[model samples]
Target chain A: MAELVFLKLGGSLITDKRRQETARREVITRSAQEIAAALAATPGLRLLVGHGSGSFGHFAAHRYHVRQGNLEDWRGYAETAAAAQRLNRLVTDALLAAGVPAISVQPSASAEAHDGVLQTMAVTPIRTLLDRGVVPLIYGDVALDDVRGCTIISTEQIMALLVAALRPRRIIMAGEVEGVYTADPQRTPTAERIPAIGPHNYAQVEALLTTAFGVDVTGGMLDKVRTLYGLVTQHRGLSARIISGRPPGAIERALRDPSAPLGTLISGDGAAASPAVGGR
Target chain B: MAELVFLKLGGSLITDKRRQETARREVITRSAQEIAAALAATPGLRLLVGHGSGSFGHFAAHRYHVRQGNLEDWRGYAETAAAAQRLNRLVTDALLAAGVPAISVQPSASAEAHDGVLQTMAVTPIRTLLDRGVVPLIYGDVALDDVRGCTIISTEQIMALLVAALRPRRIIMAGEVEGVYTADPQRTPTAERIPAIGPHNYAQVEALLTTAFGVDVTGGMLDKVRTLYGLVTQHRGLSARIISGRPPGAIERALRDPSAPLGTLISGDGAAASPAVGGR
Candidate 1:
């Protein structure tokens, strides 16, 4: 087995989050193709994939505040989980069609939480899947919470759980936008992509993200960055790249060679001298 | 909601267990229709349904002895789970098409065992689903075990877990044969159907089950009786019926009226004097 890599296909990139239960089939298929190509290029590159529920689950989660937990409404918890699993079936079927040998490891089934914080998850199935060279695909879903009754767990938080168990070398996030920007790129015309963010510059970047106007619209992205930043900072030699999956072959390029340099690279102690090439 | 009912669709009833991944789609569809009709007829019945993996999971499980647990063979664990989930998809899809609001509650995802003894399971989802008038469909699958690494949990055991959490009035098990017989009905021409078995006659019934020739061929059926016997003995007023599902309207008839008396009734102590009409 080679160095392990964790790849996240962001919900916004794979589905139309603004709509209800709408999946961007082309995007999912293309991403699957890119992943298949990457594996073909590097046969020994161990990978674990997670996807977000996007419109499928987020609507119900937000409407019912499942993330905050709802003891009174068990329907909300079940609906959230069912919707997310519906999308997971789509994504995993596409991966299998592309010969990725993808199997779903539903987060809601194995994950338990206390006050919205993930506590225990069955990681043996996942670790064993990776060990046997099978791509275990996980997704965001509802989890049982001791305090809240039931809560929603995001793909990043699930990844964080996996990270604690299986220390991967690189984390690749494929989303709609290119990478983390100095400002909200959609609103600000002068927003520049931050090429490299390390321990030394993380505080500075955090400040920019906090003060940036219209960042609230992309609040999910901000949360993702914060989660990834915390992960990279905690584990040395662990790096994360937030890259765009829109352009053709970008994901394939990034995955085939870890140093392909097409996204915002966040690292810990090492790789401070990485070049500031704009993620286009 | 009215009185709750736990229904188990035996693997041998729904799928060709001897074959690999073969599903009797007609049986499943008809069963779904019967359930839908029954629920429609009795509007207030709260139901929780469970199905066996049949050919889907049993093949791999038996091949690798997954029920016995194997620490070195993780592939077997995954394969077993995947196979079972595939069958669940088919069953759930059929139920949905038949106008049944069936949502799969995968047992392996939430179930844990210590040396094959089911310890902690997240029963909130199933309980809540029943409370909210939604049918939660659970199936037998691979579960992580503390001492053995991984093992398979059957639908009967899963029901036993549910029986402890939510005490339903009755349990209906659908299988290929009608019910418990005085001998191996398949091999013995003189085998007579046992109308009912309770604490009063349990010793005699066990003697018949054990001394019967060719009973080992139906070993799974024997296990089912033993598990159900344990459950009924522990929880009074809760009776179980083992009936054949081949007849078009047996399930619908049984579900519509709790006292329909179509199968062998295994009761604790309350129903010992019930009529001894043989289960046809």
Candidate 2:
């Protein structure tokens, strides 16, 4: 039986900001179906899914200049939030279409986190959905902050909040790039693809992080890894992985077999890690 | 017959921010009653009202560093908007309670013009409210802007928008003080309340205009007169008056009779004038 797994779908993996997008509804749907199939085979696995705002959030933020809170740009914040909402609805609807009895927990309604980390996540009603064999689909949203005002609540941040609250044992971050890389594949020609990494790989992890992912207004990949590592290690017993979201079936394949080297795994010091080959 | 009016309610007239308040709800309630009564007496006079965010908007915007666009403060904009929303609902309820049949046209739903004026005002519904003797109420909101980002669309701006769009014959701006004065009442020994002046009364208005008045994040008499005069005289058929919002039942008197010496009136010639006194 596999443990409870948190699946994080990165916006970059699912969207192209260069083009206006209708959330990859079909893809998310198919993925949910596949997950449901896989879960039937593994009775003990608890699955929680979260997707990003994709092309919707980033482009709208840039279009409206929401980053610069001028007196005139206040409504830009509202419009930007509305865009995130449209994308969120698409994703939630897709899950339900796949027969994943999903519920939309609008982050804005319960977004009063102590410093944005979910001091009180009203996710109990969400647990009922999972019990009814329903998938509670979570996504990146326009979250209300007590500090920095309105901002993109990144999928990674969503996962951290869920992990701290849900106590998921295994985490998988899926994206198109086949897993976390040592550097940008397009920019860094020789940037190595990290097959697997853990707590002991601190130097290796820090070296792989780049400040070049286009100044994320809501933080970026580096932010995700840094945040994940902190949360998982603190839990003492939680095991997590960073996996490629691509090949369409990669997530299911990695989850089904422990040996599949899909991404970096962050977890406990005492946990047995893959003795697999360090990829080039 | 008095012309339909667009009124901007200043912050000081509503909330006391220094003490961190939801404001005395009765002041807002009574003011709604007064506006309703005035409108009822003069069937020709209709009002589109906008109120300031007061205690909620100021402290939150600054305390959360919302303008800085920090990651943590993402929801601050919404939080503050909700705060103003509470006041708006209260005001609307008050008017309804008084049998005025008022409706709140939240800024998010209304079309605006650069926070300076309004164009394409879909005031049919508001007009409907007026047809039925209902007042259309608005508030200083976290307005959605196409440019100049996240500014508090001052109630003055909303009133300016309302006046320009509706081409109201006269604007009655109500504030906490007795009326627009010749000098700041708090600072000057002879800051005699200017009973009247020419339309372009900035010189006198400036004298009376203090830097700020408590929870009034918007500037003093200068800004008030400047925006009102700018909007009213944009064409040939409009005029405006600046008067005290306090001392219950005063605005009603001014609305009921043009001869009422309620506030300083600005006419089309860009010279200061009193509502009925004419320039001395």
Candidate 3:
């Protein structure tokens, strides 16, 4: 089997969450270049890219109350789905321009959630493309639900499901912040970064991490940690690293070597000791 | 089971094929209105709309040589797929504006082809949406092929596959011309229009029909007839009608009455007599 990696580009990294439908073009282009460099360094590496909806999807979904399901009018569903696709297009285009063969795969078309939990996902098409050395790009979107009629599915949720099916070597979560911190680093001067986490220390770290501030329909850092925690605990061999994409070489480093002292690492064994008071 | 119809809006009808990437917005809006009116006239009607790639897809697919497959460069695949999605967005937007509740279900994300033959398609999501009374809008797109690497799959091919799964009440092919004529209507004034075609008279009528003119990556009229002929013949109960979308009430009439004397009908049994052409 080829070495596969699942990477999530947090919406905050690629788009301006403060403004509706505002894409951070320069940041996205730089990130794509970094990803391309990583692929060049690692031979036979297959990647599955998923990005958060950011402002593009969240604003429209919120305006229409799309996540509530069973709306008096179904037009909101169409609008929400379109907005997500628009963002996916922008992300895929940047990757393509940066020499990555990124193909857009909308989740709503092939995924279903029953009461906010993904029940069935057709991943064969994605698998075939990945085997052929093509990058399959996915994103958060509105999906049909058996119990709720229709609901919003987050990128992290979709990635967790994909990790189970594809069994990627490692998952790299890239965002604006360096990693999970003891508290909101921006607000608290005494806060410190947590370098490593596992089932043993997950609850302790979870209590310290703060939810991201902005217009995010999907729960921010807390939801991401919760989803990754479940996957890492269940799949002993799998681990996920959370890193800041803003730095020059953070993404490549996290992808190339997960245990590097650059960012926080979450695993099943909890073998690595926490590095203290790292300078940002 | 509610009544379902598989309606295909030919790219030539909704777009200016002579000009690359130019969508005929006016025509699309008019067609949507006709479809909406029909849905209002008949209660409990469900629809699955599939449109051709038109200028948007054909131009990129041709430029990239995507259909030939096994190309040295893979970037063409991403380009081609992006082009198709652009057109699908425009179409879905028009349907939503007309209050049709159209949702885009991208074929490339959940569909695979083996040597240009569709191997697997995750149609369950679409089925669920249709069950909830939402129109699942699909389009011709670039698909990964096991044998050829990647190939372009036409809207008719996708719709034919859906017919087997959904077993819609009828299939309507809306295009620029009124119907399949005995000869090139523009060149041959004496040519007559064939009202009905079946297994018995298909070969004779097929030889007389002319292929559509333009830059269509997928073969035009001849290809449509061959696909529908195979489908209608084997299914026995299934029938497809070719009609002009330009005329007022033509699409609504065709959807409501497949055997109506408006266009060419391909059926298992030859019931309607072939109508001779008097004038256009």
- lDDT of model number 1: 0.81
lDDT of each: 0.81, 0.60, 0.80
Candidate DockQ values, in order, are 0.26, 0.02, 0.68
Tens-place lDDT digits, model 3, residues A97-156: 888988998888888888888776778878877887789999989999888888899888
lDDT of 1 at A253: 86
Candidate 2 lDDT, A181-205, residue by residue in tens: 7767767798776655566775566
User: Per-residue lDDT for A28 in model 1?
Assistant: 95
RMSD of each: 4.4, 18.6, 4.0
* Model 2 docking tier (incorrect/acceptable/medium/high): incorrect
* lDDT tens digits, residue span B180-279, model 2: 6555576667767665655445555554455433326326566666666666558566667777778888767766766566777766664344335352
Clashes of each: 0, 33, 0
Could you give candidate 3's per-residue lDDT for residues B1-280 as a string of tens digits?
3678899999989889889889988888888988888887877688999999888888878888888775566788888898788778788878878878888999888888888877778788889888877889999999888778888988988988888888886788999887877766777798678777776778876665533333243246777788888888777567778888989788887766545677777777543343321111
Candidate number that wins on lDDT, 2 or 3? 3
* Chain A only, candidate 1, TM-score: 0.95
Q: Worst 10-residue stretch by lDDT in candidate 3 chain A?
A: A271-280
Using lDDT as the measure, which candidate wins? 1
lDDT for A103 (candidate 3): 90
